[model samples]
Target: MAYPYDSLLPQVTRPRTISPLPPSAPGEEAKDEEVEQVKWKRPAVVTPQAVHSKRALLEKEQEQTASSEMPRPSQGELFPAREQEEQHRQQVEEPEENGQNIKAEPQAELPEAQSDIMALKRKNKDDMRRVQEENLNQQRGDQQNQVSERVAATPLMKHPLPSCLLTNKDHVQAELQDSEASNKVREKRLEEEIKIIRDKANRLSQSLQKQVAIKKINLQGLQRKQLTVNEIMIMKRNRSPSVVNYLDSYLLGEELWLVLEYMDGGALSDVISETFLSEEQMAAISRECLRGLDFLHSNHIIHRDVKSDNILLRTDGSVKLADFGLSTQLTPEQNRRCTLAGTPWWMAPEVVTGQPYGPKVDIWSFGIVGIEMVEREPPYCNQSPASAQRLIATVGTPKLRHPKLLSALLRDFLSCCLQKDEEERWSAMELLQHPFVTSAKPASILSQLINSVKKRKKN
Candidate 1:
């Protein structure tokens, strides 16, 4: 309903506003008073920084009041004083242009100097402490490594399998069993191969002719050589014996298996038993025995059982060595064996000591044979084998003391031959050239005896 648009503007109406309720209750009045007091007490115009500072100062003050002791400030506090007092203090404390404080530059530099010194001391101490700790750690590591190495080196008893390994035992066993079966197959194949080789060897041996050429030997003239007790007795009966010589030869394989030689005479031992072997006799026998030993040794053969029983004498009183069954060929520079394989009575000290001995052992036995030839019995004759062994181990070297004997030469030679140490024993060749055996008269006598024995056989 527009009436007079130009005459009147649109009527404007005032909006109603709601008003807050007035405080009237006594409790509410008290709360409003508290809130008003808090607002009045708070600072009116505070910045964020000043407010934060004020809060911190209040908290500090509260903490100081609550604590039993309060810490003092690092810097001293300045105080407001009367004008005359301030003037006097300033004059006394401040440095004058020509005062000692101004002149004492070195003293003023002391604090800085002390701080630098303390810093260096602290650095050095820290370095030393660090080095010490590193060394201690290194030592500890070394100890641990040593302990672990020892543990690894020590053999351990059998142990139960680990739990995880035990769980897979069936699989492991299957693998091992397969390997064992393969080894069995390989062994069977090797055995078959060996059998084939053995069969081939047997077949080849059978197919091939093994012919042994037998030389025609004169059997009709071969005398049935026999050694008889009567012959031996007759040979002993004659002190000035007939000369008998033996052709040096070896024969093998007979029914009785006898080593036959034309008997010239019995051993010099038998003669020595009945009659005393004079110095000439002893020297002659010694030279002959040494010659035999030298010849045997030069052939690398050791007549290990060198004794009166083994040394046969011709009727001409010349000796011939026999019985090479106990002999062995010694290699050059190789020590003899420890087979405990010689006549117990003739064994060297080294043999009794249960050690490997060389051909020097024969020399030691030869010394015993020499004693037997001179005395007609073993040195420790009456004792049992055990007792003899004990005596030998202790002191049983043959000692001779004949007035007519070559004391210096014979005694020293026998001593060397009977040495307990194998290294010290004389070689057979060395014994052959010794003065007692090699003297011109003794050598000539031995040569005459040997030639007579040979001539008698020839006749």
Candidate 2:
């Protein structure tokens, strides 16, 4: 406690040091004199960039070695001076400030000028290879997309229920059972709707003094499948109320499907055959047909076949001119069709005589149909179809079976329609203004005829 102040002051302490063990193996090694002498080798100090460059150089050397047997790169192929001596001379003759270069030494060189060309060749080869790989990947992607689209487009069989009622039934019975079970609710709903429609029609007739045609609706699902391209085109013609409506078109399986308006009144020929129509009724029918023909002619279409068979009627008193299978379209400048394409009996004298006819030919056919309305048959229905054609070609004009039954004005209209000179034939628009066509209201007249025919058919 009584030590000097200097000794008691805080002092800095040094760290304790431990020495390593000394080596003594040299002495034993010296005793073994037969051991080979070893030299002290220094390790190379390599950076990350140097290692990468070394790898690239090795790859280049491997490529050059391979190129001796395989195809060389485009750049290397152009320069053939790849000899070792030339390389050495190029290395020794450095670019000195002189007119000519002399070799300073005999050693191969890594010329910086050639370095750019080598780098460019290597880069181009790599880019070309990468581009080819990308193209291959794109092609693979395209093929996969096409396959997926095809699979998505194809329809597979889908059973409705999880459990099956395999109660020892045949194939037909099984199908019937399955169909009934699936559509039972839908069928009941449709039956109720149909009942409502009939009741509404009856109620409207009683209360509002309006009659509606209540035909049974055919409720099969329409599919756009199995229709030919030509049928589709015909169905999708330019629409007028006189023309049938095309609702939709689609593709199913290997076919095209078309949905069209249901024309239930049957063919015009059936109506004519089933009932004897009055003159006013005949005039009304001719009026509506002329209207349709006028519309078609105005649009530059030739209804080559114009007969009762091609006309259609709706339950609610609408007339539509149907069946354009043989119809031809004329250009804005053209006015004639040279082909003879009408039905043998309905063909015009001009058409039968193998003359170039225009929309006027349709006028002749309409005249025959007018005659059909009065006679209950075409002009030469008793004759063979061949004979009918020959008669049409040679005969002056078809005579109505009962000319006394037709009024003088009506007879004159038919005469205008059946004119031998197409220049003299009454055009559809002009025929629409005829005194015969003006005698009746089309909707009421035709509707009466249709209702009577329906009653006759039912009886």
Candidate 3:
């Protein structure tokens, strides 16, 4: 089959150099018409140098291949893009000059393929730049994340205090804690102290209550020991009117305590008025009464209420004065009697006259008591207390009846007992030696009375 022109094989035309028209005879015109005709082909001329360069490169490749164990290069590998650019430029310039026919598709194909290489290089560079940028950004992000993590994990740091300020602050805190602890300890100790005080107060209150109870019991016991008035009056009714004896007494306590010796014999006025007393009875009662008074006076005690009701008779008929409730001791001046006290009938003239009386008044009252005993009634018994006081003021002294019936010794004793003057009164000891009470009978009588009282209670 015949190939179409479009698909025909390419034919290259080359120009050969004719021997330079022999330079015949210097002026012979260069053959204008007959000289050797030279044929020029654009492709041949244009490609020849390239072909030689390719041949040299191929030789180098061959040499490299022969010497090395490496494989031979491909046609494209042997001629680098730059060398290919120079070859294309040579080919293009020749074609343009010679108006040669060229395969447009191959030339265009070459430029396009080269542009692809440039594009690939640019793309690769862009990819590399992008990758590097991504790496940088990734690093930045990682750095930012790390910074965020650190910021989140760690607390912000504060500025440091000065060393002195720090030390002072620590010291102050320690002192404050110490003070609080000390206060707590003090509070605890105070609680203990309060508890102790409360316990003491309770115990003291209990002790005081116990003491009051004991005192109350003791006082009740003491009050219950005495006899009742009704029982005493009954006993007095049974006894003889003139008898005064300890046998009529009552025992008052569990241990036979507080014996009340009887203080009766009717009244002294009754005893005297019934009869003029025998000398023996007069001497006995009078001397004993005086002795009792002297004993009281020596003790510095004043019997302010000495009277017939207070004069007691023993069972054997001896006399003893009693009831010293209103008595006073002159030893203490404040104890001096200020109140008027005594039987009006037997009151001393000084007492009746409203004079301040001391123990000496006892002597004057004793004389009056003596006068009543001898006569058996007070000298002013018929008069009222006021009239008797007036009588004492008007009369100098009292007189006793039956003065002649009385023995001289008894008379003198009675006179001595009735002496109106206090200084003239005999002391109880002086009267003890007087002929009246010197007999052993009164002493015997006292002993017998105490024994009788003791025996009566036992029986």
Candidate 4:
């Protein structure tokens, strides 16, 4: 029988890992779409000329969808029937327009097909990227073919950079622009610029070249050296997850393969689907995430990207925060990191604004994840990543609005996690003591959500 968690939890790479990163899933895992052996279809690249054509096709589809789709009875009127229709319309036609297969039959419940929705959406984005890459390759190919033709026909000009052409007291500015047309040592455009500069340099004399050269005494002394994470980073302490087991790592030519334990439980995002988590349920998940955040913060590591997707679960009610691609290992001297990393929807404000941030950024992300647990998606889930970042940076912390609907204590808890001032924001240590977290049931409470998913999958 097909299992629910089985489809969700991806198989992982178990190689002896060379880097200090945790055990990881293999990079080349084929997506769910390709698993069905469907022939990959390539659509014409989206270009400005085709904009009207694409728009008219979309409008025709929307008109047809509206007429055929009957509105289902609103489920308690909390969410509208139109919302479902819009989602359904998008799901059905989005892939077809973007060059992927439409989903089969509708399921009785969202849980049955929820996993595929994300997979298809992700696939659509990947297809667009592929189209762009192909266009880039074709452009580069054409440029390569014309390199010699351009070199013969076009006269050499001064370097494009203004610094190179300035009339300031620089002596090199007096010489004629270099006219070496055959040379292509730099980038295609840059090589042309360099040849122009070189032609000017040749006229100055061999004496100028002699003055510029600082001959090396010995080339034999230079040798390559070994590299390690510790050499580049000042890691205060190293931490590992109890669930994500590290196996082995070895070098395969240019790439290093790391083996990590496979998580059978998939992600917490999967748990959020098809089920509305209660306050108690949110507390349990939040507490576990906070515990992990605390561990990282204490060790002077910042898990810059903290979101539901990055959190992995196991069958035994254990949850581990995964995906350390954006994680930073700060030394004792470093107070904050200025890198604008992490998912835009869940990003802290300071991070979006390019402001230096400390461990508290993770706390902000943790808060957003808590909100995510309540509403299957994070805040601004509907917005594009660029728009989300713009809105978040301009607006102060996002308010849940309609707060009276949720409990007062829970509202206060959100308030604590989402403080605009990083200095004022409650640390994970402090949030652990809140009544919401304090009264939260043990990690065992999560098993209820997991088991329900499994049962539904089994059905």
Best by lDDT: 2
The better candidate by lDDT, 1 or 3, is 1
Model 3 bad stretches (over 4 Å): 1-259, 262-276, 332-338, 443-459
Cα-based TM-score, every candidate: 0.41, 0.49, 0.38, 0.48
lDDT of 2 by residue, 25-93 (tens): 977654332111111111122234535665589679878888777755644356656544343332232
Superior by TM-score: candidate 2 or candidate 4 = 2
Ranking by lDDT: 2, 4, 1, 3
Measured with C-alpha atoms, the lDDT of residue 435 in candidate 4 is 92
What residue pairs clash in candidate 2, if any at all?
224-257, 225-257, 226-255
By lDDT, the better pick of 2 and 3 is: 2
The sequence of per-residue lDDT tens digits that candidate 3 reaches over residues 331-384 is 565544555667887776667777665676676676666666566676888999
The full ranking of all candidates by TM-score, starting with the best, is 2, 4, 1, 3
lDDT at residue 340 of model 1 (Cα atoms): 65
The sequence of per-residue lDDT tens digits that candidate 1 reaches over residues 81-120 is 4544433322223132452233212222223323555556
lDDT of each: 0.57, 0.69, 0.56, 0.65
Q: Any idea how many clashes model 2 has?
A: 3
Residue 41 CA displacement from its true place in model 3, Å? 99
Which lDDT value does model 1 have at 177?
Answer: 99
